[model samples]
Target: MRTTKTLAPLALAPILALALAACQDRTDDAEDPQSASTSEADAAEEDEEEPAPVSILRPDIEPPELPDLPEVPLEPLDLTIGFPEGGMELDEEAKATLEQVLESEQVATGAPIVLRSHTDSEGSDTGNMRASEKRGELVKAWLVENGIAADRIRVIPFGEQNPVAPNALPDGSPNEAGRARNRRVEVAVVPVPEETVPDDPADASAEDAD
Candidate 1:
C-alpha cells in the first residue's frame, strides 16, 4: 500500500507541471497583443502632436519694392476774358476762353470763382463804375445759366481804376490797342480748404465706413 501511494503521486506530478506551463504560455500570448496595441496607440499620438513641415514654392526669390510717386501742387487758375470795343457782352472768343478755363482741373472742382471786371478810361468815373458793374453782372448771369452756382461767383467792378493799359498814349493820343486790352475780366479760383483728420484710429475707421 505504501508503494502504490508513492507511485500515484509521482504519476500526477507530470500532469500538474504540464497544466501550469500551458497557463503560463496562454497569459504571455494574451499580454503580447495588448502590449502591441499600446505601442501602436503611442506611435499614433506622437504623429498627432508633431506638425508637418511647410513646403515653399519660391524660398530663394523675393518681391521687388515699388518706388514712391511724386506729389504735384494744385495752383489756382488765372484766366482772362476780353470784350470787344465798347461792348459789355461776351463774344464767341470770350465764350471759348471761359469754356477752356472752366474745363481746367483748378476751376472744375467747384471752388469759389472771382471775376474782377475792368473798363477803359473813356467815360466819367461814376459811369465807368456803373458800366463795369453791368459787365460783371452779365458775366455772372451767363455763368449761372451754364450750370455754375450763383453763390460760387463773386464779381468785383474795378471800373477804370485797374486798367491793364492806358487809354491815352504817352503823347496824349488815344492808344486803341492798349484801351482794348484794358476791357477785360480776370477769372481766378479760391483755394480749397484743407480737410481736418481725426487722430483716433477708431474714429478714422468709422469715417472710412461712412
Candidate 2:
C-alpha cells in the first residue's frame, strides 16, 4: 500500500509539469507583438488581389482621309470700329472687317481711305488728342502693312470734340455703350473722277452684240 501511494505522487508531478508548460506557451503567444502583427498583415493581404491587364483589339480596315475645306473669300467693309476703352488692339470682328476692306478690288486700285478717329470724353484734352492720334496711326499702319498705299490713308483724329453718342446718361453716370461708340474709327473710301468714254471700237462692237 505504501508503494502504490508513492507512484500516485509521481504521476501527479508529471501532470502538473505539463499543465504549467501549456500555460507558459499561452502567455508567450499573447505578449508577442511580432506574432500579432504578422496575423494582421496576412489578413490584409488576403482581402484583395492584383487587377488583370486590359487588352484592346485593333481594327482590321484603314480609315479614309478627310477632304480639305474650301475657304470663303472676304468682301468690302465700310466699317465704324468700336475700340476697347483706351486699348490700341483691334478685336476679332474689327480685324475681320479690316480684312474685307483689304481684299476689296477698289483697295487694289490705290483708292484713298479716310480714317476719322475719335476718343471718348474720359481724359484730359491733350491726352485724349494724343491717344486718338496714336490710335489713328495704328490703323493706318495696319492698312499700309496690308498693301494699302500709305499716302492714300488720310488720318483725322478728333479728340472728344465730336461725340457721336452721349458720353454720360441723364443722371451723369457713364454710359458704357455710348462711351464705346464714341471711341471709334470711321472708314470711308475716297471717290475718284469718272473718266469720259474714249469710244473704244471693240467695246462698242461687244455692246452691239449684247
Candidate 3:
C-alpha cells in the first residue's frame, strides 16, 4: 500500500504542472500592452478626423441704377412759295422765300429737295417734256449758285401729261389760262429727321432723374 501511494503522487505531478502553464499563458494574453495601445490610438485618430461646422453669414450688396433723360422741343415749318408770271422763273418774292427757307431753319443733312417743272398743252408732248426738263435744270443751277449744295436737289420734269389745269377750255379747246398756270416749276423741300438737334445732354439727364 505504501509503494502504490508514492507512485500515484508521482504520476499526478506532470498533469498539475501542465494545467498551471495553460492558465499563465491566458493571463499574459489578456494583459498585452501593445494590443491595448493600438486600440486606444485607433479610437483617438477617429475622434480627431471629424469635420468642422460651416458658417452662414453673408455681406450686403447694392444694384446699379439707370440714368435719366430729358425731353426736346419741336420746331415750326412753312410750306407755301411763289414764282414769277409767264415763265418758270424765280422772281424777287420767290428768291426771298427760298433764302428764308435755307436760313431760318437748319437745313438737315442728307435731305433732298425735289424741283418739278411743268408745261402747257399748247405744244407737242415731247417738246413740252424737254422744255420742262430744261426749266428744272435751270432751277437746280440757280439753287447751286445760291450756296445750296447741288446734291441736295433732285430735278424732275412733268410736261403736259401731268398738269394742274383743266383739259377743256371755255370753247372746248384747251384753256389758255389753265395751260399758263401749268407752265410753272414747283419746289418741294423734304426735311431730314436724323439731322435734327436734340436737347442738351446735361439737361436731358436732369429731366430724366426728375
Candidate 4:
C-alpha cells in the first residue's frame, strides 16, 4: 500500500465547473415560466396572422341631378272694378269680389285696405271730386255693413284723374272705352303678416352643435 498515486483531479476541476455553470443557467431559465411563455406567444402570433387588404378610393363619383321646381303666381294687391257715370253703388260683380277678399283671411289679419275712386271728367272739377269722394264713401259703407271696420278702409278720391285709357282719340273724338276705363275704383288689399313659428328645442340644440 506504499505505491504513489497520480493527481489528475486538478485538470478535470475546470471542465466540471464550466459544466455546472451551464446547467445552472438552464435551471434559472426553466424557473422563470413567464419568459418562456412570452417567447412562445410572440412566435405563435407571428406565425398565425397576416395583414388584411385595403381598398383604394377613386375620384370620379358624382351626385345625382335634381328635378325642376314648380312655378307659382305672384299675389295681386289691387282689384279694379268698373263703374257707371256718377254712380256711388258697387255692382254685383264688385260686391262679390269684395266678399271674396273679406273671407280670404286678408281682412282677418287686421290690416287696412284702400279705396281709390275715380271719375270720367264729365262734370265740374268740384262736382267730380265730390262724386269721387261719395263713391269711396259708398264703398266704405258697403264694406262696413259687411263686417269690415270703417277705420280699416281708407278713401282716396281721384276725381277725373289717373285714367287708365285716353278720354279722347287722336282726332279729338270721344272714346267710350277710355271713359269706361276711367270710371273705376281700385281696392288695394294689404297682405297678412306671416306668423313666426318657434323651432324645436332638440333641433335647435343640434343646429347649435353643428
How accurate locally, in lDDT, is each candidate? 0.85, 0.81, 0.72, 0.79
Clashes (candidate 3): 1
Regions of model 2 farther than 4 Å from truth: 1-77, 197-210
| Candidate 4 C-alpha error for residue 34, in Å | 47
Number of the candidate with higher lDDT, 2 or 4:
2
The top-ranked prediction according to lDDT is 1
Candidate 3 residue lDDT tens string, 1-210: 999999999999999999999999999988898998999999999989987776555445445587776544325444333332545566787677667667644454435778778877766889889988887887778778878899888878887777777756778886766766677777776555554454698887787799
lDDT of 2 by residue, 133-156 (tens): 888888889888887778899999
Models 1 onward score TM values of 0.61, 0.54, 0.49, 0.54
Local lDDT at 68 for model 3: 72
Best by TM-score: 1
Stretches off by above 4 angstroms in model 1 are 1-70, 199-210
Error of 4 at 3 (Å): 90
Better of 2 and 3 by lDDT: 2
Q: How far is 73's C-alpha from truth in model 2 (Å)?
A: 23
User: Which residue pairs does candidate 4 place in steric collision?
Assistant: none
Global local distance difference test of model 4: 0.79
